[model samples]
Target chain A: MKASDEERRNDAVIIRTEGLTKHYVLGAETVRAVRQIDLTIERGEFVAIMGPSGSGKSTFMNMIGCLDTPTAGKYWLNGQLVSDLSDDQLARVRNREIGFVFQTFNLLPRATALHNVELPLIYAGVGSKERRRRAEEKLELVGLADRMDHKPPEMSGGQRQRVAVARALVNEPALLLADEPTGNLDSVTSEEIMAQMETLNENGQTIVLVTHEHDIAAHARRQVHLKDGLVEQDFLNEPVETSA
Target chain B: MLLFEIVMVAMGAVRANVLRSVLTTLGIVIGIAAVITMVALGEGAQQRVQEEINRMGTTILTIRPGQQMWGGVSRGDAQLSVEDAIALRAGSDGLLKVSPEQQSRMQVTYGRYNSNTQIMGVWPEYFEMYDHQLEAGRFFDQGEVQGRRRVAVLGYNVPETLGGTPPELLVGSTVQIRGIIFEVVGILEEKGDAAWIRPDDQIFIPQSTAQYRVMGGRDRLNSIYASTETPEELDQAFAAIDGIMRREHRIRVGEDADFNIRNSADLLETRNEANQTFALLLAGIAAISLIVGGIGIMNIMLVSVTERTREIGVRKALGATKRAIMTQFLVEALFLCTLGGLLGVAAGYGASELVTRMAEWDTSVAPEAVFTAIGFSAAVGLFFGLWPARRAAMLDPIDALRYE
Candidate 1:
């Protein structure tokens, strides 16, 4: 079967890196947080970066999410070279191309769920009406439509994480980056978030998750383990079945 | 649209910390209130001085007796007589309208009611010089002054003080001044107070009547008033008066005369200058308070930025540019100051009203003062809000996100 042009574009690689490295100077000692890591994440793929303490998984995730620039490396997101982009340009890249789900949920406590979801759109200069419509649609998609007006403090851990997922998806970014997203949740809530992420991956959303939990990493179709600032192993895995 | 969102975000942040925000704005409020109230009082005092200058006749010069010296030794007193006034009137080439005045406090009675009143003796021209209007009867003419007629023009309140008789009824009636009977020819209208002079409470009569009949034939006059039609002619009138007075007093040329010619307008202008200086000094002090208030805003804004560091990190991660973050905080500071300015203006207006009611002082709140007060407060916000906003904008997203 011949795929259409849009399908071919969708099949293209979403992220490519060559010798991505990051170093932090702590007084006199130089700490190499991420070193000589080469990785690629294709469209419609779910990948988990797993590591223990003192590993470089978090630093790698930060560089991939466009929150930090690699000290020495070439990196591209959706075929655009973004390794040396200025701070403001990188912010734009993060806004348009990457959606971040931090471990802390990172939702503004004072804003409603709907408002939290609408934040990226507001930064994108969307009109209020259209922004509200898209935010509502995303919240509904995450099964939080009835709790749209609820604040983060008023919601459960699972519900707040779902709101974070909704916010991450609201901009329709090319890649979703979740860093220890289930770290603060109980096992049941973590399972629920992982199922939701699996559902999103099944629907052709590219995702890169960072976690130290083996079971959480097991949910991804591929796993890359990092040790001491280098990739120790990279392999594929059979996706875990979702009960929902 | 983005700007609007940012402004709303700033407003939400302020609303979240209601007590802190209110306490932060208190400094600006008191500062602006002090500025407004002080300026209002200064402007009010200036206006009053201007009114006094206008009322006292700007073109009029009063010639008072000065100490006469013989080789720098003091003479007990020098005199200005009716002749000096007549000489000024005749020799000024019709440039001056002159009147000699002699006043004494005396008891006046009418219909068994008596009151202590100020009795002023002068020419008919005195009424015109002071812009005195009559409520009833006619002013005694020059003929009455030459004839030493026992006719008087009562001031507006004289009738009320003398047993509450009406002005029109008092005119054409006989009243005794120092037990001497005089006919009331006219009643002057209410003139209000002008500086130290209260024209509304004195009784005016012919100069001859005062000198020969009431003042025990005293020939020494108190002072002579000379006026020019226009302010431009005042200098010429002054020179003429100086020459004429020197000749009348028989003093030599280039020697100091035994009299001083003071332009009433100049005296009032000096007083006005002093009033303005005092007002400006007060306004300056008030402006210092505004600066101190601005410093307080800056301090609070710094604390707010530090407290919201994590929020700033989240916003930056969500695609907020440095300019956007800067604008958000700046708008917050500006909003707080503008709000304080408005409230301060209200409080200041109330304070000025209170002063007017309690102290009986005339206070005019100029519209310009209101506008300037608000504008200055906004500027204060902008000036003081810059550093905190810059610090917020310069924050590293990763560090901020990691801040505990």
Candidate 2:
């Protein structure tokens, strides 16, 4: 049966969070890392969550990425109630719906760029041929096709980040969650990597990045600034001024 | 991706850490070699003993006229006689060959050189029936036995002591036995010593000469050597001999017979039992080395798990399952053990050969030992590897990724 535009629009509500909160105990005192907050993310949305250090951005990102559970709230990803799932089920959710990119470009040091890209596909149970094919295509999209066999150490910082990006896209997940995706790279390399990510987001890939740099956050269509573990500002980016 | 891929990944991991892996497997190699070589040595020694016993003649019915002591059979008096031998041989049904031997300590003098040696009086057929080969003149004829000729056949040691004299000269020469001159007629082949008798130091003479001329005792004979037609007839032959001797000696059925019958098969059995015990002891010692090898594997695996904490974290973060992580490390451990087992098998063969050549030990590496070592090493890999593999698998991905 062909789905109508209304059904497709309703499917836009890919990830939803209601009063999500996380608390941790340090010695005898409880530290509320993520205060109660409500958030919703739609499919094909490019979102940037900007925050200062220790502002609970990482905690919220972890919960949203399914790497952690919210202490006092519910999180639903792809219509599944994720906060109530077992560890294994949560891991499956992360594998199927959430692709994470760390600031350090956490590609396995000894593994080839291609192998790094194939990791998510490996967990998704893609056969060897399909995994290789899809990983090659992803690396090609990230403009790292010629460097597919290079290990992380052999590649430049920008190249390594691109490989990480390719790995994040390999599973075709609902959200690409990047934590300071270019934090360690030089300005030129960081801009080059950000351009590739912008291209991906323009092609309808949903991306969520945590960053402190306004220049890097400018690539996203929507920005959510957080301070003191609460949302301080939310805004939309104007259309790219091609004629300027 | 799959189990096979995971195993391949593990193998690649071991290959990357070649030196560490080899060092871990060294213990197993030594253990396998020790077990195989030690067991082979024990088995070889036992076979030598059994061969010695078998070559000493068969179906030996020893008639000792002593009484039993506290749970032990004492050496009886030499009350056996030629008449007893004749009676048993003539009356037995399955009798093929029988010889009553008398042994006495005497001085053998050839020219001016005199040596103390055992002088044995054996029948004419005793030499040939016992696998004895003559390196010189023929044995005494029937005429010489019936005539009670004073003749002696020198054993290997006696002849050597005589300055390697030619067999013909020794045959015709007169050797004084107990101050009486006895002509040498035949020289028996070199038969090595049994557990009790050193044949090379003994001289053989006719039973007539030993009993009537030299011993001057008519009623006593030493132990008798007998053989049936075939090994299968030994029991029947022994029964017939025992029955005849019992009847002739007038021993009633209720009384214990005046002899004990010892068979070559029994000697072989004893030797086999000793060999089995020796083999077990050797295997036990070797197994300790294998355990040591297993410990080495465990130790190295423990270190590897710690060192690869970051890598494990990355894999976990990348969606590798706990089972996949566990299987990867376990396969690496198994691979290490298998390498050790292969090298140990080669080392065992080399060691066995070295022992055979250098120490003159009879060493034969058994195929069973190879298979056993391989299996044991694999078991050790699995057994000792589990804890480390589990540790790798159970690590928290977040904490592991954070490990410096």
Candidate 3:
């Protein structure tokens, strides 16, 4: 088959969900957390999934991140259909493809910044020498080279988040997924973290960020807003530049 | 993940909770110490018995008066006489020699010191039969026994207690047995407890002298020691002696024999068997503590799982499989048990030493007992740690992450 430009463009899409739905049976109540959602995110594109507290944005992000399977419908990542994958298989996909930056900056409290970044590689069965080298490089990338020996508790909130970001990017995952990455940081630190994200994206990395703040969502070129377990709007933004 | 890595990680977790881990291992330590101590006690007893057998020949037999029970109401042991000993030797084949013994508690004095101790009166053949060695002077001969002379052989400790005089100096010294002056002819070597006889504290005199003078003339003998040349002749020699005793005592046939002829080797064998059973029983009781120890590990591991739920969630989200989680907890349990087991071995050594010093008892710990104690602790770890480990592995990651 001769591939057309539009077809080739669609081929670049890293995440595509078709009629995805998730419902939980809580005792006598059936809560539909995510309703028939169809979305497509292409490679090298920065996108923000914006939603309020009960809008099911977190649930949808979980599906896209391979953290949860859809109750019914089709989902694909890097063109591989993963909706039917087993729990263990989905974990492998999450490890190799998705990098999570949690709202709370879930860095292991007892580990050094360098060791925290080395975790993904350790899970990937990398040797100690290689793990150390890659972890150092990632720590250096996030401008925390001197702070590599600091533990999460010992560091400032901003530095700890930066350590989390370095950990997220160390695996060279296909998509950087951050869920309210700046929830615990002050406004100034939030902007500093967004700048780091922008730099990574500018360097040809794909990022999908989940946030409730309009300003934080505006930093991405495209935004998808959700309401009541369904998509409310999808649009592109000019990414109005900000000064720190 | 590598096995070594899992163990290292598990050890790190265990080390982080130092007090709790050590507390969890306490039961295992106690269990292993009990097992080791019991085994050591049994072994020490067995060794003492063996030494006693060597001092007295294995083929030797002690003929004590048998119990006379009428309708299960015991009338105590019957009395034996020297006539029985003489008659057995006269009517016996495969018998080498016999010694009739009679004992009495008496007060003895030498110089300005005095002590109360046992005096054993026996024939000359008794010394050779018991492998008794003299430290100084000579043994009383049959002539002395027949003449009812007042010569006596002092035990090695007799001099040390009476006046602290040396063995050679005690020889030719006159000591009063039952307030009657008897000249010390020989000093016996320091032989410890053997054949249920404490030879180091007693004085030995001729049986004729004891029967006629000390007892005011009585023919009754306390016991008889008889032996054959070889171990193989033991059974036949017992039977011949039994016949002699029966005919002398004039007990009717098919009736309960008046005397009990027991071989030294048989007694030793029975004692060794009883010691084995005692050790095994003690170890079995001790193993229950290890099971209790394993349960402690499980309890602490469960608490740990709850406390580290968020950590488990993070690990699961980082691509750790259920198998990895299971391995981590299992390794943690095994580490605790093995650590406790090793510590218990050292404690058991200390315990045995304490037993030897404080209680004046012999205690020996065997290598096999140590190995078995360690292996049992591992089995306990595996057995009781299973449930908690599986519970940790099966936790839902999302729920765990959201857990407070």
Query: Interface RMSD in Å per candidate, to 1 decimal?
Result: 0.8, 1.8, 1.5
Which candidate gets the maximum DockQ versus the true structure? 1
What does candidate 3's lDDT look like per residue over B1-404, in tens digits?
45666787789899898998999999988888888889888889878887778776787898988877555677877778878877877788537588899998888887788889898889888888877899999999989988999999988788888978988888898988888899999998888876566888988999989999987787777889898888888888878887888888777678788678887766567657766786788788687877788788889989988888887877777777778788888988888888888888888889988988998777889899899878878878887778888998888877776677
Clashes per candidate (backbone, < 3 Å): 0, 2, 0
The DockQ of predicted model 2 stands at 0.40
Ranking by lDDT: 1, 3, 2
- Candidate 3 residues lying further than 4 Å off, grouped into runs, are A1-13, A79-81, A232-244, B23-59, B70-76, B87-92, B106-117, B136-153, B157-186, B206-209, B212-217, B228-258, B261-295, B342-352, B364-384
| Cα lDDT, model 1, residue A242 | 60
Identify the leading candidate in terms of lDDT.
Answer: 1
Candidate 2 per-residue lDDT, tens place, B260-365, comes to 6677656456646755776677688678878888888989998988989988876776677778788889998998998998898888888878988998867676
Evaluate residue B282 in candidate 3 and report its C-alpha lDDT on the 0 to 100 scale. Answer: 72
Predicted structure 2: lDDT: 0.79
RMSD of each: 4.4, 5.1, 4.6
| Candidate 1: CAPRI quality band | medium
**Ranking by TM-score, best first?**
1, 3, 2
